[model samples]
Target: MSAPPDQGHVLVWQEPVQEAWIDYNGHLSEPYYVLVFGHATDNVMDAVGIGPDYREANDASLYTVEAHVRYLDEVSAGADLEVRSTVVGATGKLLWIWHEMWVDGRLRATEEILGVHVVGGGSAPFPDDIAARARELLVDPPEEASGRIRPLRRA
Candidate 1:
């Protein structure tokens, strides 16, 4: 899965919405969204050669420094979900990724993530090969995360 076959293409990862992930209201739970996005994240990581092999060989790993998610719609159990990720930005030590969650051809959610490469305990630059491969997949860096201010809605 190193860097995927097509770096410029969307990395689509698909999975079913699990029944155990449903909440009392019968929709996907808050935490499960994070977990599914994480599955996509792991796919991206493996693609960029930062997986278990890298961890074992280089003694380096990634840590989620920050993340932002917007829940736009509900996802029910038994629905098939697709999470597509595009690398939006990256540096020697940091990777910025944006993900869209699709259900039935409709966009259901979005997640933006920032991960830092860690060697030992502190952040360190990514390996040259990894960095170069990721650069090929880069997109326009997103705007800085702004604190959201929710407006009143119809009740």
Candidate 2:
């Protein structure tokens, strides 16, 4: 998919919460949130021409270097989920992405990720065309992007 016409977030992925994703407390589990966000990342890769097809042809792919995820609200099993994603920034070899998960128009979670283009078991610059396309979709990072977990006080 191409960048949104107004340079806003793109609706990158959609899926229902899986039954197995629910935890014992009867809500969507933490790891599953990351899994769904990872799928959104894959969709973003596809949008910028670095998907599985490209990986097969070029022997390269993008790998996440870091990620921060916030679970804003509880989600029940079988909820219809929609993920909106933005290319917050891009360079020759790196991409910064932001993703929001919405259920019935309510924000449930958010994720920010940094990824690097990798080839031959090491980081590498993206092909010119792919880099240009990624840059074309770039938008300003969200206010909450790049946040870190708070440290705990010693007892």
Clash pairs, candidate 1, are: 3-47
Over 4 Å off, model 1:
1-7, 141-155
Candidate 1: Cα lDDT at 106:
95
Q: In candidate 1, what residue range of length 10 has the lowest lDDT sum?
A: 146-155
TM-score of each: 0.86, 0.88
Q: In candidate 1, what are the lDDT values of residues 44-147, reduced to their tens digit?
A: 88777898888898888889888899999999989988888878777678887778889999989888888899998899999888888787776654453223
Candidate 1 TM-score, true structure as reference: 0.86
Clashes of each: 1, 0
Instruction: Please name the candidate that would achieve the greatest lDDT relative to the true structure.
Output: 2
| Error at 110, model 2, angstroms | 0.6
Q: How far is candidate 2 from the true structure (C-alpha RMSD, Å)?
A: 6.6
